[model samples]
Target: MTNIHAPEVLISEVGPRDGLQSVKATMPTADKLRWIDALAAAGLREIEVASFVPAQLLPQMADAAQVVQHALRHTGVRVMALVPNLRGAQAALQAGAQKLTLPVSASPAHSMANVRKTPEAMVEEVKAVLRLRDEMAPGVPVEVGMSTAFGCTLQGLVPEDDVLRLAVLLAEAGVDEIGLSDTTGMGNPAQVSRLFKRMFQEIGPLTGAAHLHNTRGLGLANGLAAYEAGVRTFDSSLGGLGGCPYAPGASGNVVTEDLVVMFEAMGVSTGVDLHKLMAARAPLKAGLPGEPLYGMTPEAGLPKGWV
Candidate 1:
């Protein structure tokens, strides 16, 4: 096995899309742009800037196109957007998103509740989206996030077999990558390691980011487990915002600042400056005045004699 402590890791920031969308208040377009710029300036190479859902469905993301256009200005950062179907994919591509992520729930119940489509139906949707991508934007990559890859609140203990099967199906459907998401925050370190190891074995290099939530307070532990399993990319939100609306008691993605601190402290290079990354939270707060942000590193300053 490769050294678990490999020096470089990619911390893909999802705050602009996942974090903001969970809040009640809608962040202004200019403020969203400022937040994205700040995150990029802090060395985040990839950011999910927006989701191309209907404005009525998620008013917070009403400015998805505008946010994607502004995010494109940051040449060093890869602009990403979440798309539920082919129309959303087309909008994202038209808005110049460099990467697209589509969520496919592992639990059949959660799938219907969240996207109103069964898991198999979602796979077909991915195929259609990929076909559209081929016609409209050939080079841009589409990633399928297997949400509820862990146990689901609606349907307990999502069989590992189901998750792996969906992964294979998505890979067969022509996705650029398949990321595992603990959408319900019901995963442990052991489960994370085992699942990610199996994922790499089944899909090889198509394995992508580990999207873990802190709802059960094991976010960092699970992240470390994935790292040990040779997963290099991680998906986290600033201030630990966002959760699946379809999953009860699911809240808070792994906090970006905290994840960065953990990796950097372990001598793993994330290329993200801790102070700059934490400071980016200022713009986030400014955007949504009353929204709450969570991160232990920010609440408690860096340790003494620490570099």
Candidate 2:
């Protein structure tokens, strides 16, 4: 078996932040930490542990600082936090977050609805967050995903040109990396490949992870499409936790266990253990008992003679 130190693909687990935020119940702090440890033990090098939003907006992440502090204890995993604006970024940096991801929605309506700011204003906010990171936590990478990149429930059929333009704008704003997000779970495989390709063309070295959801049940297919398009990093959740909270009909994120299986089966090293990854689901279920978990691989088990 190849070592995880340099896997062919990077699985960035977003269950803690993305998954937890969308759910109604707030997971206990200890349970959250245990889950993070479980994920790290399963070989996920990066984990979006918490979102630094106002407690009023997301009660589930009310303990963002605590979660970030605990997650940082894992020396191997890159502890990431999502911040909607400069204030949230400040809180995340103060809590010792290793990486920062901001959602800059492409749809004007989504931009306003999610963050109470226009798309252009969100870019300015990214610049502010970038400046703060430079002054306080220099070298802590900042990644921004163009949410609603494929389409939006508020605004149907987002123009491809608009998404590409936002990617370039974010790159120019000095964000360390730019990612395309299928926030609405409306993205198809063909669109996923083409948009990410164009994102690479525009941002080049800064093109980052593929943040796709399974609201429409195409998460794995879209992930494969992104991989073939040259995207190496993917954002997934343990049980495909709470889908895009901002999107009305969006369901869950790409399932991490299933995704690792898909990649490893294709001879692509995801650096995650299929056995341990599935086992990690215990803590997740314990944390959110009634919450529905989604993933085909976890339910079906590994195939006979699966590598």
Report clashes for each candidate as comma-separated counts: 0, 0
* Predictions in order: lDDT: 0.90, 0.89
Which pairs of residues collide in model 1? none
Over 57-149, each residue of candidate 1 has an lDDT whose tens digit, in order, gives: 999999999899888888779999999998999999999999999999999999999999999999999999999999999999999989999
Q: Find the candidate with the highest lDDT and give its number.
A: 1
Question: Please, what are the lDDT tens digits per residue for candidate 2 over residues 126-207?
Answer: 9999999999999899999889999998989999999888888888889998888998889999999998898888889899
**Clash list (residue pairs), candidate 2:** none
Deviation in Å, model 2, residue 131 alpha carbon: 0.7
At residue 48, candidate 2 shows an lDDT of 96
